[model samples]
Target: METRELRYFVAVAEELHFGRAAQRLGIAQPPLSRAIQQLERRLGVKLLERTNRTVTLTEAGSVLLREGRAALDAVDAAERRTRRAALAATGQPGLVLVTKAGASSELLSKLLDAYAAEPGAVTVDVHLCGIGEQERLLRDGRADVALLHRPFDSTVGFDTEDLRTEGQVAVLPAGHPLARRAGLRMDDVTALPDLPLPRWPGPDGTYPDGPGPQVRDHTQLLQLVGLGRAAAVLPDSCRAHLNADLAAVPVLDAPTVTTVIAWPPHSRSRALAGLVRAATLL
Candidate 1:
């Protein structure tokens, strides 16, 4: 389907009302409705169920909404990357590498230093983001490469090279009872009544139903731990950055986190390749 048709369908599916979707798209309702109808006819399936007062997605429409969003994102990213490429050709060349804030600092430092020493290295701009945002940045072409942790960050559509695999630790207030433990099991941490694990926002920036403080980044979570308001499970490497008010005890069974350098599969930029090479080398 055309990108215009996909956009019309996505807008309608999201709003569930042609009037609102048309308003959002800066078009008339009739044209929007007609476009969706033509799209459904060409695709040979009912994409939506429309009654007098409400509209809902059919199973096929649900699938298209998901796939259509990705397709549009890919198209947007391509346009952005192409424009950035032209800018690079005109002498503003650089690679933007993104990762979670306060994570893998030592590894990132070393990787930057190593890449800077390469023969034709360009400027590497490091973008420190909040939890689970690196994938989106990379996918949207705002970033050339990203340092992603597996099982926490999705790496489904990228080319990646595993960098470091480390165990996890439960971070708690220094004065908390669990802070004195030599190590902890997953159950021990999960069952803590006074220090529940902090809730992190998903990709949609909404926290799941939970009885923990909502947090956006490691800095906030660590501050919460320091204040004795919550607990957190993070990569063992985090121990190096812990302050005196907080403590990290190894969580014996927490799944290991593997840090990987990820980039789009379609990227052919030599500088991005150099950055990925530098990351894997470290």
Candidate 2:
């Protein structure tokens, strides 16, 4: 049962001579012989056949020797691996964060600051990448964790946490007709004279900015409205951070874009949990 006993038994079993096995083990021949005797007695098996001039292994001794060597090798490997893991977790390691290239960059900046504020030796490496790249990195195990927008492909196998909700708002040109309305409903804006709401892509199937109003990236579409070129409705949160020149009205009747923190299924990491917690705080 003791590792020492196993070691002594194997030494003598392989060498078939206690004196030689003791030399190999850097121990006295008497102790090595006694260890083998105790091991065989505990197992209730005759392991060795000793003669005046020759020594030989019994059937049981041969089998135990083969399996004992394998057990010792496995124990050595497990100990080495455990030490390596301890070093990785507490010594020095970087937490990987992959995210979409939009507002997520701002969100990560805030999280990184919070995570770094903790005491002790800990730090993070942020990987700010495109939406497609973030998804790919998470899928391929290159990322330890990530923060992303929801309504992603379910097939990507991601989990999400709702960070914040940004509702629809309307942007209007500085001098455009209907600019005076406290808040123009989508229907009201449509009815205004030269409402100039960018024409959502018609059946031609292109996008509004792309050729669909729905598909316009925040920066470009917001630009058009910021210049007073047209009125736009976007998430209230996005508008909340905009320049004084641009204004947004909530579309009480429209769908809202909710920002969520997403990651692959079954993903578990302490650094990730901290980041997720920090994101909601901001």
TM-scores for every candidate against the unseen true structure:
0.97, 0.49
Q: Write the per-residue lDDT of candidate 1 for residues 1-282, one digit (tens) a residue.
A: 899999999999999999999999999999899999999999999999999999999999999999999999999999999998998999888988999999999999999999999999999898999998988999998999999998899999899999999999999999988889999999999899989998988998889998899998898899999998899999999988999999999999899999999999988899988888887777
Worst 10 residues of 2 by lDDT: 208-217
Model 2, 203-226: lDDT tens digits are: 234554532234234566667776
In model 1, which regions exceed 4 Å deviation?
none
Q: Where does model 2 exceed 4 Å of error?
A: 1-92, 98-109, 119-137, 140-143, 151-156, 189-216, 228-231, 280-282
Poorest stretch of ten by lDDT in candidate 1 = 273-282
Cα distance off (Å), candidate 2, residue 257 = 2.7
